[model samples]
Target: MTETTPYDADRARFTRQAPARLVLCDHAVDVADGAAGLVATEHDPDARPGGRVSQAVQLLELTERALVSAVIYERERGSSWAEITQYLGIGPAEAEKRFAAKLAGWDTAFDVPYRLDDTGRKRIPQLPTAAYDPAWACTQLDRWAGNRLILVDNEHPVSSGLVMAVPKT
Candidate 1:
């Protein structure tokens, strides 16, 4: 008989959570809501007819960003090109060709974590904010999963078992 450890339990929970694509889509919806809120506050409903079109265009950018992030997250989690391609309805080579540059950049960020800004004062992180600070990402994602997923234990973070190098603060 095998006994399951707490880590195993958490890993199981993490695996049960939605795939990266669905999670990213949920995030895109949240971003769209926020953008809509900003547009609503900044102008009247009838102020500009073209504003709606522009907002829709802007949301496309958010979707693109989310896609890239989802790819990065899945890759980091040890997902194979074949596995990812199945969801995208593309060949593994095509998927790799499309995302290779972004994956290279993500890998390179670890070598040089930050760069000086134009002012040569403030430091800007090269990695995506979530990648740069995985502990925080884990916390946030876990909380979101606990709230959104059914039968998840709120006390245990779903992503706690993920292997991430947390930067020392």
Candidate 2:
């Protein structure tokens, strides 16, 4: 038998409220503030070198990087790998390899389709997903409604993912 975790319970609760619209949003401000707080706490002489603050800072950095990747993917939705690589300052293979997972998550979060019509021709739309919008993200955060659920890792002060929750309203 598998042991049940709190996360699993939360997910179950979230799923039971399914058929509800889920919205994903970026955690830009939360990540920034958390990073700043970590830096501040770390600056204290009494604080240990590898304490919660240090760990939080690392997580915040990762979240920031993920957010950056999401932004780039949104900005260059239809661009080729070569183009994305150039913009990201990484080689084609590296770019794809590094961002593939994150991009997949983003794609799912945004409910982006495989193709869109452009000029009467099928083409990929750049940032077709509204989840990347900072304003939308903020609104969701404020409302706390819908399938959008913010995942806040205890280790980090800010959220990691803006998961959609079942809309109560």
Candidate 2 Cα errors over 4 Å, as ranges: 1-25, 39-46, 52-72, 109-136, 140-169
Best by TM-score: 1
Cα deviation of 15, candidate 2, in Å: 24
lDDT of 2 at 67: 52
For candidate 1, write residues 87-168 as lDDT tens digits: 8999999999999998788667655656778996666777555444444556677766676667876654455445433333
The TM-scores of all predictions, comma-separated, are: 0.61, 0.40
What candidate 1 gets wrong by more than 4 Å, as runs, is 1-44, 118-120, 135-169
Q: Which 10 residues in a row give candidate 1 its minimum summed lDDT?
A: 1-10
**lDDT of the candidates, in the order given:** 0.61, 0.45
> What is the TM-score of candidate 2?
0.40
- Model 1 scores a C-alpha lDDT of 0.61
